[model samples]
Target: MSTTSVSISQKLTLSGSSSCNPRLAQAPWEFDAMPGYGPGSSEADPVPAHAPTNAEARPGQLPQLYRELPEEDLHERIRAAKEALGEDLVILGHFYQRDEIVQHADFLGDSFQLANAALTKPEARYIVFCGVHFMAETADILSSPEQSVILPNLAAGCSMADMADEDSVEAAWEEICEVYGVDPQNVTPDDDGKLPILPVTYMNSSAALKAFCGRHGGIVCTSSNAETVLEWAFERARRVLFFPDQHLGRNTAKAMGVPLEQMPMWNPRRPLGGNTAEDLQQAKVLLWHGFCSVHRRFSVAQIEKARSEHPGVKVIVHPESPMPVVDAADASGSTDAIRKFVAASSPGDVIAIGTEINMVNRLAAEYPDRTIFCLDPVICPCSTMYRIHPGYLAWVLEDLVQGRVNNQIVVPETVAAHARVALDRMLAAKPK
Candidate 1:
């Protein structure tokens, strides 16, 4: 029987967090455990024999005791459970996670980095990912079959991922196939050895999409390796169709000297995805109509403000931000790249970052010697990332200590088998 992919809890609400709010800014552990994003939404067939056998058994409420505990007690509880579990448990914290959650992380980095980190610890049976849904799903995909990946809070879902669902993309593919008068099922190469279009999905997408790419001879890409991934795709196909984040696709392709006119945004709502027949014929990259709300919030105005306020300020932005914001900054990269840029700077450098609030704040705390701050003066963490409160971490860990696997994220073998193919292609694209 097929179980839906990981539930989309954060999809229910944008986010109840605000950096401006004193309570939310503090260590507030209390939260609602919203569940399910419809059935059979973003996954595949039969459960993996090696995956958590009790896939049907998942987390429910946030346990009143966890919600009621003071910040110190909550942290102490997590530490105690972590100590009790020992090598059997490994906590992976996304860079966007709150400081409270980060403190308990055995491994800390971006999602792709964290997934690779899981492989380093073969002895750890439980991977508690203090990140969002897609991240936990990735850990499940890459980790040992005997291991289980868990998300502390079920509601921590990425809004950008939700933008490109499986069904809509399938529909788009069929339409594109009709335009090229080629079979969508099999992308045969021409005499020049280039296919009509090659699909390239951002790592932020659902596992179902990754499987789609694998089945159709496409590949996956993390933000850090988009350029390399694109180069790989171009070598195989005449053009590309990038999904779930138009900004990333646009910015990366633009840097590679792909003209703006040749990169058309695909709007699922319109016929031919809002492109004329000629646009599709001339298209080099068909960017999906999707984006990250947090990155999209950044604008050219914010960079200008930072420059005026801090003399000789060095600016850097994530490519997920709109093209204008990326253009205004001195450099554009993935989460890891942004961190490295700051690390390499002189101690006295005034660095203004355009990304999530929690990450920027964490960096500020890390490098007290440098003048580091977020470009957006208004405090707002990524709505979804903030869903992972410390309360949930304490609850899940304690439950694991009790021999109960709550919030277990299990990807079906059918899905993981195909998704891994696409993920492997991404790994191969890494710079040597």
Candidate 2:
């Protein structure tokens, strides 16, 4: 709801920062940023006045100027980055990142997992986040202010994270309070309290959102730990109001055998609690109408098609997928879980995966003997992640090498304290 800043420790080693060190695995590829051709630093290739601009032009006349740039000296750059920065810089990669980038990551995991990984790295003065914007922001919030956090590309962001913003959250809170005569701040234990109006936000939200949950006596949850987190929330609250992605909340609750009729959809724009008698009285969970555009593209029909076309085709989907998509899949989990499954499965197994395109492509390459394809065979990527091209990563790393730090994400002080409240609650929750 409001912004605040937090101070971070400037230590550079991962040991002093986090309580534990994450075990990293070697990647199949390498990162190479050529010396002279850094992002936004190269001399623009000049267009000759005589060059033909149209496709109708003859091949020679069209553009002899289209020469490929030299490939980055992968090993050399990696050695340089490691040697120069040492513990001062920590590179974090999400499981969904391309293999090329993942190869260079000091830490690799899902969004919340990566943030948890970054928090323990107190030795690092700088964190170069390789995931979406919200993730980097989360790192900033969780870490000390002295430690700088940079997103390789300022443009990099997450669609699912963007679905709910400050205004929307405030508006919803206002309506809930107005209709129910319940203060979000005053909810507490009762001998027979109907259910606490507990707010469960996904990890894919802004730091401010997390802080809102924290200040309001709520907690945060990731895809892998949703069930346990929800169980924790339910014990304290009268009813759970899960935000951003309705699909994840619905799917997890359903698996727990909570009937579909008990979960109501919250409409912030509506009054009367934004619910019908059946929706409010019978509700166990209140799901928001947000979803990931990428995951939502996966359909039951696609899974059926994959099964029909190939025998033993296992369908694995992200929890953010639509209800039907998750229902049709053989299994569902977080990005890291999906990768682990593919890695552990026997060779020659056919798998249809529902997640971001880059991850699916990487899995297909890694497991050549096994058939792997996207559940939605469309040519779309996580638009925010698409912003983190090799060029962007190189530029940010280069900046850290210099005294300049561009696009540093900082979670404000007040917000960080409140957000920590929610995160602390989550950390205390036992696994189901």
Candidate 3:
């Protein structure tokens, strides 16, 4: 989620928008280039761009289309459902969700932020999370037991989170403890000095894993505030164990000037902890062997190509990408930061985005005067995010209207308590 203040001339018109369906809109969006305006140059020409590459092929990438209502009727139905459901319904959309569903979100942010938002709405009996399954579970953990969290599509899941499960994480933690010849509880400290290990989990993880973190004085984080959460951990511990997203963990630690060698990737499958004391003793961050398939698809070549093709293009990428990919781009940040930079940017600027395809397309539409295109030339939408179709959203809302709760996501009481501790730490870190 990074932004750049570069400028370019002309509008972008890629070939993919003319498809009959959203899924078929695969052609590269075209943008005009300005001379000498791109990275390393004050001005340059923008080049034609390609679609996103390495999109995760999540199952049910397309939900079944049950809604046959016309545009006006559909909106009317959605409004009526909301009115009937009243306080019992809440819609939460993730930052990477399609604009169609996001436009209807009552609350919008990253997974961690969205979960926190859900907690504030005590009156909402049913929280319809518009993100992936893990995000819905996070909201469930944060919300009161009396509340019900529903995912529009259960298939929506984070691939990164899938990389780390409770068993695997537990194994890794044990290995870390054994290698250090220290108890997990005695490894890290908090201001209270009560908890032994500060088990921090990423929002992308499973509820069970999150429960593990909660049980261990750890919290969850989205890409936006991961750095702050990690920093908070350091203040209370000898080292940090970041789960479910090695890229985010590595990049955040790197941003803090933590030596790259200090961050070791823990592999639960094999022993020796997948790291050495040299790597661990010097460790500032302990990364789980996990990654987002979609984010990892971004490459340095894409950025370089963008620069050469679009003479004046500014490169902006999400930190979830590999370090090289992030470094190749002119800027890196959260998705919200990227959007803000583009919306408020000056006209005639060229932007090459390294994010989901739908998001880049929406931005291009929002800024017609500026040249905007995605960094990856292949299809690269987050498969999990794409699982949340308007059809599924409408169905979930309609079910709530009918006084039925389907697909309710609930974290156990024990797990909830621990998860809250982790979540509270993050909320406290939010800038006042």
At residue 405, give the lDDT of candidate 3.
Answer: 74
Q: Over 4 Å off in model 3, which ranges?
A: 1-75, 185-197
Candidate 1 positional error at 75, Å: 1.2
lDDT of each: 0.79, 0.69, 0.68
- In TM-score terms, candidate 2 sits at 0.80
Q: Which structure among the candidates has the greatest TM-score?
A: 1
lDDT (Cα, tens digit) per residue for candidate 2, span 63-156? 1111121225543455476568888999898876656567778888887678678878988999999887778877887788689998765545
Would you give me the overall lDDT of model 2? 0.69
Would you estimate the TM-scores of all the predictions?
0.88, 0.80, 0.81
Worst 10 residues of 2 by lDDT: 1-10
Estimate candidate 1's RMSD in Å: 7.7
Identify the runs in model 1 with alpha carbons over 4 angstroms from their true place.
1-59
Q: What is the lDDT of residue 200 in candidate 1?
A: 95
